[model samples]
Target: MKKSFLILVVLLISGMMSAQNGGNDMKKFESQLPQEGRGNVRVAYQGKAIDQMIYEFMEEQGIPGMTLAIVQAPYIPRIVGYGVTDIEKGNLAAAKTLWPIGPISQGFTAVAIMQLYEKGKLDLNDPIGKYLKEIPEPWKSISILQLMQHSSGIADYREQKAFDVSANYQPEQLVQMVATLPLAFDAGTDVKQSATNFLLLTSIIEKVAKMPYHDFVKKHQIDYLGLKQTYFGEDIPNVKQEDVTTTANVHQTFKKDKDYINPSETTTGYVEKEGKLVVAPTISPTSLKGFADIWASAENVSHWDIGLAGSVLIEKPENRDIIYKPTKLANGKTVPAMAGWQFYNHKGLMDIKGNVSGHSAFLSRFTDASELVCVTLLANKEGVDLTNLGRKIAAAFDSSKMGTGANDDLLYTYESLFSVDETMSKIEKVLKTMGIPVFAKFDHGKNAEEVGLKLRPNQVIVFGSPKVGTALMQENPSISIELPLKISVWEDKNGSVWASFPQMNLMAAEYDMESNPVIGKMQELLEKIVIKAASQY
Candidate 1:
């Protein structure tokens, strides 16, 4: 009877302790909540209830694993993980679960370049030939700044499928392969996102730093920022199989019924022979160094973001600003997007996103001088639209921003009442009526079909008046990149045809050009053209 009474007392104590722990957890969550109107933390995101919304989103999106980190200025970041890392093993995702960050690695590479710049090791205007000889003609003249801005005009190697999944090449070989390709345009005349640009930048970093690319990143970015969970390359020391999140299985043969089998599950074979499953070939991360292949947890990425905001890594605040600042062309017009980052003047935010074979990641940093909020998301699945997803989460804290809520500079979109072809035809007709010259009309869908590929209805009509365009270009010749203006008519997923173009006024602001009479006239003319094309017959 006495022993039974002792056991009862112990059970009562345990129950009381569990309740206290729960209260403490609640208190911690409450402390993290934005105070009333200060952060404008939306009603739905209040308290600890945001978890339920995230779970529902994961379920709706079919995301097997996801890690998210939200940071508000000087406060500690709130990092959380949702869903399972491995479907077969049933391993739960966690904040520290590592996931490949894909091309987001370029941001880190950019930082390393800036660090070299800060130390006076290299000049932004220095030609590529200065760092390494035998770079060939046009590329030799390309400046370091142009490479960072993707204005070097080097053709992208990925476009040619130059490297296979299993192929590995040394840095020099990668540069040589790119050299064999012709320039897209003259250096600094236009901007295009090219992995080749980063490859060149990586080579420059290696030469300037006199160290291996991965080692430099490890010491300067990963270790310096105290990102314990971050690492370069595919392997992380001392990490177990279950500790890392696997990329979503993108192969068609890997699917079981309608659902995808976990790539991490060794028991399930992905091979197909006469409709039977067999052992699948192991897929490795791309052997390309510096431009891609960095892996980190959501929590570590947030730490890097925080370090970027603070003086931890780049000591000078101005140096950090240079990393995201738009590239000013020779004629004074600037590209809104920078090296690895994109600037959104409407909302005062800078963000970067990357997608590789099986992973998608997004990092957004709000640049409001008074307030600091950063959102980092890492997911195992490709094609998840991490930009929109990141923006949706960012809106919970501040919803006043506009323009897609992401860093994409597509400032205008107007749905058309007609089909995509009809809309393009109408736009062309309007241009002809206005006496504007149609420089080119590209049928992208038709081109894809010619290549035995399927694409939704899409076309671009390039038209501009020489009188107006010349006036703008005379003001800033760099504005020519935006000239020969093009309007894209495409069909969205829901079968709605639409016309989209960048806002002229926003472009004016981005280039820092004074609003002239011609600017206003061009804006008015474009709006009328779009309206006429999108109007009901």
Candidate 2:
């Protein structure tokens, strides 16, 4: 009876889960990932019993299905899918199940724009009108970066309730919706996670790449990353939710005796009614969804993958390719945010509630460990909870004794200016790294030519500390090995400035020197030393 009912009625799920049904999906992991062997990172797996915990938690709480991909330390990555992708048909969910991973793709859009920048096709500060035949208000003053970063005052498509129609939308229509609304604030003054910003990004990609946004996703990110499991979600056929009120096996757990299975594509926008699925979507043109090109089902789940592959890049120096910043919410609340957690920073959402959708997803490297990466794919879709899943995973790892660090050689890189600093940052992310708590002080000396600098220098600075060095050596004998630090400035072939600080390796290695007490003391002393040394008159 329940089987027939689930097939008839769709489910309106929440973020709650039983955890029990999840099985080995939860628990400690002790596997080896060797990224080099895998063309990215390689590894081996003794695969921990995470599945049992994941299942137990999910079944106990009611999360119907979940997919997990962990790049275990010292080995290759592992992916596991638990529960039903679709509860009605008893379709089993696999790691390959197509779900909407929202705004996190916006950064990819930014990258696409950068690709054009690399081709000398566009400038970062260029106005939107340069490419578009028509520019909206403030378009003349709005730079591309402003739009990419949501510093633009553009309102969002999901801000209004009616825009939640489950049908596909034309890209232009989305633009029209944005245009109808007034700007939330002037570009670059304030920030809101606006779908409108990404709409512009899509429009810009289409204008420059000469392809639709979806196609642009394919040509750049998906193909470049070889991401078989990720997508823009436009090509995945929609599962029309039948009811808005009925509740089925959403994130909530089901009766233990019930032998109900989840499906590959669960209904996201509606709920089950008297065992009948009812899709209660706002009236809108289905064509706006852009899913006319998609027809994915069980027979062809692998055939039509969505094509946006902009997420975390585990490799660094990334050659100045990745750009990110942290900001407090305008509401002025001092509490930690969706963007604050370590290894897992999120800005958008595609959950059961539909709060934020359609922007960026983030997975930052552990700055203190072995440069390991963690993530939460926050989408703009209303009422989805994948980001929550990431947070749970991060907590599990952070609090567990079984956790290990990455063993990449690059973890011991250099720190010069923002360029090299960023590289060193990537290498030391997971090793319990420390921030540049001490600012670098600069002393403008004579030009390199005037001072007899041998090579062509972008700039030069004389940096040292005779006093601090003596004090440190007296305080601790081992501290003498890393003294006498200096920074050199120059421009790369690209003409961008680079700074170099050579002592990161010495400090980083000290933190790993087996003895916990010494490492802690060294960190405390280094923090003070850097601050005192950089103090300027």
TM-score of decoy 1? 0.62
Q: Per-residue lDDT of 1-537 in model 2, one digit per residue for the tens?
A: 998777555432222233443544433332433323222321221232345546544553345555555532332244566665444544445544544433334445555666667667777678877776565656666777666555667776665665654656766666666676777776666555566666666677788878887777566656565654444454443433223125553432223422222333432322334534343342232322221112222112111111111222212323122333332223442211111121112222111112222211223233224234333322212333343234344334442211212221222111122232332233233122433222343333334456866542344333334655565556566866665544444444332333333434346456354433444344333333332222110
Query: How big is the RMSD of model 2?
Result: 19.2
Worst 10 residues of 1 by lDDT: 263-272
Question: lDDT tens digits, residues 284-305, model 1?
Answer: 4445465666778887888777
Model 2 worst lDDT run, 10 consecutive residues: 335-344
- Candidate 2: residue 380 Cα off by (Å): 14
Task: Give candidates' CA RMSD values in order.
Answer: 17.2, 19.2
For candidate 1, what is the lDDT?
A: 0.69
Give the whole-model CA lDDT for all candidates, comma-separated.
Answer: 0.69, 0.41
Report the error of model 1 at residue 393, Å: 1.1
